[model samples]
Target: MLPYSEEHAQFRDTVRRFVEREVAPHHARWESEGAVDRDLWRKAGDAGLLLTNIPADYGGGDGDFLTSVIMIEEFMRGVFSGPGFRLHSDIVAPYILHLGTEEQKRSILPRMASGETIGAVAMTEPGAGSDLASIRTIARREGNELVVSGQKTFITNGGLADLIVVACKTDPAAGAKGVSLVLVEADRPGFSRGKNLEKIGMKAQDTSELFFDEVRVPASNLLGTEGKGFAHLMTELPRERLLVGIVAVSVMEAALCWTLDHVHERKAFGRPLIEFQNTRFVLAEVKTKVTVARTFLDDCVLRLMRGELDVATAAMAKWWLSDLECEVVDACLQMFGGYGYMREYPIARAYEDARVHRIYAGSNEIMKELVARSL
Candidate 1:
């Protein structure tokens, strides 16, 4: 079991209540509307759920990474996917907190913590996904400003992001060494968002096409050292991948619980499903698999807190747990039989939401490549 202090327990309770009160009721509406309501972001901020790990001086909760973990686990337990809170709190906020100038942090992190400004990192372009070096997005320096021109697809929080950390090739001739990260405000003159994209899963989370047409920003908007963006991404990605593993294991745990509850109560062939030998065996396998996954996930979390989690171990955790999550959730859904196929059922939604864990945070294939290089 993971270590949890009394404070952590109280924080978990807070997140649980938030999920029940703010998320569970209107998620279906958000799903139908193709994105979550903007009000939810403000509410999450007010509830101290937006930036739990950010320092309190910056309007954050002054908590550790475990707080974010609790939020993910609680949300996934409810099959809640409408909000991009994880991407906002754990992923985007950290970029600024870690790499931005002190002035940038002083200005941006407080607004992000309060949900006044939503954040996104735009890295994947139309022609580039895993190949970060191949991106055609260019940020040409003009005197004291950088004019950015490119299109980014599949950006999380793209529809309502107030600030975006866009990855651009500031020195294209240097290949990977030329890449840079630039902070672009959403209302910049040439910046525009395409319609929210529809997906088979994660329907309620806004994913969109972002266009940067000569959007210019002061050179001061550069995040980290100019031309060091790729290395910066490498340094931060382990945490992001570990976050995906946390989500994967949580989904597996919840899926197993839903299946077990169904098997114990549902009658099949005039007998409770749990009484059947095959039913017992299937659940047995699932229980063992989930237990192992939980143990590994906890170990990874500990390593992360200690700053010992490397890219290889993180890649292993991301690819393996995500693959296992898909397998386990699929198995658990099978136990629900016809009911699993219904969208209204939580298990069905869990199945849909679990899919992208492998695809995002770097595809499982690229994860394997990273692991292979370490061998």
Candidate 2:
């Protein structure tokens, strides 16, 4: 096991305390409502839990990726159901901070760090999923401003987002080379939101379809250059995937630890379930997988900090650990027998929650494709 720095451990303690007091208690209510309350976002901001990577001048915590990881693990420990603040903070914010002009950052960063503004990256269109290069959203320069058209779907935090990082083709014929990212404010004219989508899992996150109908913004809002979005995305994709991988592994660790506690106390055949050879073996195997997953995840996390983790390795971490999450949760669910199937049970909720791991964050199949490229 890699030794966690004292600072990381201290950060974890802060996150654990915050999660216990502020997040875990309210999570059940949030899940039942199909969306978390907007107020909790401010609470997170006040707690200094959002956007850990941005500099302190921009209203961020000035913390590292590990800080975000600590918060994510604590969030998952509750029930793995919450808004996608971590995604926005760790993935989307970095995109802008690294690429956006000073004016762009000035307009958006403070509110985002305060949690008054939610953020979403609109990359996945109706026709585009993992093939982001194929996205049809276009931004045309008309005189002084850029007019954007097209739609995005399955966007996390879509309905509530104050600004969206829209991926569009500035030159349609340029294919991937033409892609550019633009910041579109949510309240702008011609910007409309679709239904808050209902999904099999992650009910608390507001997933929706967003439309851009001739939405015009100053060219200054263009993130980076006009034709560098693809490169920018390539640079960030690994860290994004790594964040998802971290969440997958952390949640599994929480699940395994919780399940063991339950099984050790829950009686079966007049003996504690842990005494059964089958339960023991199941837990043993699950623990082994989780340990292995953690090792890989931690390595990826460290590499990300050192700026050495690449896109292919990130994809591998995402798919493999998430696949392992499903397997471990499935076995843990079975150990509970009928109770496992009940929505009232954490194991049951976890089982359902684990399903989306294979689908979202570019699906496990796409992950394999990305990993294949490295070979």
Candidate 3:
């Protein structure tokens, strides 16, 4: 049976059209500028394409998790990798929805839904990568406010984020139990964003460095209970890793399609590249991997919707699918030969974009460690 319902199919069509019209056309410019246009967020919000999984009371579309999945899949298929909509809608918004106070949700989720607020999670510090327990950012409580001080690097959407969910240490001596999540508005004093860090892939997406030099927010900005940030992150990271898996499968499929088209028409030695046994064999292998990954990912998505997805399974999907994505994209790019090496080819960009999948959302090595713990 197909994983999506009729409603999901229609939503997918809508997202596909929006990506083609608003996203694909401007991607080159976004890449050149090192970030997508801020107006694109508003447009996506207006189109009911942002925060689809949030409730209608919060200015969201009242859609399910599948709606967000459709959006991610369509965006990847369209090769619109610049916008951080998945992070905003799927990853960051859920944090506020599931953990934030009533006031915080009322104030923040609506803005996020409306695209007036771009959301980012600040977790990886200059010294801390996947080790959330080692984060040194301090959130000192003072009367009614939290004074946050730390530096966060490799923050996605950092340049354009309006609200950032920051992970910091509320108690220095407690280690993992000391971690806390604080909501800091970008306009707050002592909060500064560094230049958009240029990356090898996903060039249009702004990854940046954020410095919080004694930045303060109301104590109400604390997400969930104090000293429970690690728990909250552990609960939420499965979904984040699943999101990466979704991207991996979608990108793999897109790369396969682009390569198929290229090989069918591009002649080599007076014969189409697809006619070669080597080309056919490589593509067949890629197709098999893509199909398997998609099936596993679809199962994971359904489990996620039912609130039954576990951490170990999510890690499996994340690592395996990302590894498959890199392998497939690299093989596909080889078919394009010299043209693939140039940025003008879609396969070239896909190749570059696929490399980072293995690194981010907790490295594949870390995913293996997570899975090994369950074993």
Candidate 4:
């Protein structure tokens, strides 16, 4: 049976059309500019595509988590990698909804849902890559406010994010127990964004470095309880890892489709490339890998919806699918020959995009260790 319901299928159709109309047409320009247009965010909000799964009371569509999944899958398949909507909708919004106080939720979720405020999470710092306990950023309580001072690097949506959830040590003496998530507005004094960092791929996604030099926010801006940021991150990371797996499977499927089209149309020795024994055999292997990845990803998505997705299972899905994505994209690019290396071709960009899947959302190496721990 398919994992999606009738409602999910209908929603997918809506997202597919939106991607074609709004995202696909302008992606090249966004890629060159190193960031997407701010207007695109508002347009996405107008289409009700920004935060589909948040509550209706918060200006969201109040759809289920599967709604977000459909949107991510559609965006990946459409090759619309610039917007960072998955980070905004699936990751940041959930932190607020699950951990933020009523006042914070009422204040922020509406703007997020409407795209009036772009959100980014600042967890990875200059010193900490995957180790949350090693974060050196500190949030000091002073009277009625918290003073944050530190540097966060490789922050997605960083150049344009109006709101950022910063991970810092509120009590450095307490190790992991000292960590806290603090909300900081971009316009605040002492909070400055560095240049939009140039990247190997996903160039238009506005990744950057953020510096907080004693930036101050009300104590109320703290997300969840103080001294429990690590715990909150642990609770939410399974979903984030699952999101990575979904993107991997989607990209793998798109790459295979693109390759199949190219192989069938391109000729070698007066015959279509697909007619060759070598071409057919290579594609057969890719198809089998993609099919297996998709099936596993679908099962993981369903498990996620049922609140049964464990960390180890999510880790397994993330690493396996991402590795498969890189391998499949590489094979597809080889089929395109020289054209695949040129940026003008989607395969080239897909090749660039596929490399990072193994690095982010907890590196594939980290995923293996997490899985190993379960054994």
Q: Could you estimate the TM-score for every candidate? A: 0.99, 0.96, 0.98, 0.98
Steric overlap count per candidate: 0, 0, 0, 0
Q: Rank by lDDT, descending?
A: 1, 3, 4, 2
By lDDT, the better pick of 1 and 2 is: 1
Per-residue lDDT over 1-375 for candidate 2, one digit per residue giving the tens place of the 0 to 100 score? 545689889878887887888777777787777678898789888878888778998889898877888878877886656777877798778987999888778778888898998899989999998888899999999988999999999988987888899999999999899999999999889999999988887777788999999999988879988898999888888888887787788778888987898898899779999999999999999999988899889898888888999888999998998898899888988888898888777777778888887887788999999889889
Candidate ranking (TM-score, best to worst): 1, 3, 4, 2
Error of 3 at 28 (Å): 0.3
Model 1 lowest lDDT segment of ten: 56-65
Task: Give the range where candidate 2 is weakest over 10 consecutive residues by summed lDDT.
Answer: 78-87
Query: What is candidate 1's lDDT per residue for 142-242, written digit by digit as tens?
Result: 99999999999999999989999999999999999999999999999999999899998988999999999999999999999999999999999999999
On TM-score, the leading prediction is: 1
Candidate number that wins on lDDT, 1 or 4: 1
Better of 1 and 4 by TM-score: 1
Q: lDDT of candidate 1 vs native? A: 0.93
What lDDT tens digits, residue by residue, belong to model 4 across residues 26-45? 89999999999999889889
Q: Among all windows of ten consecutive residues in candidate 3, which has the lowest summed lDDT?
A: 1-10
lDDT for 201 (candidate 4) = 95
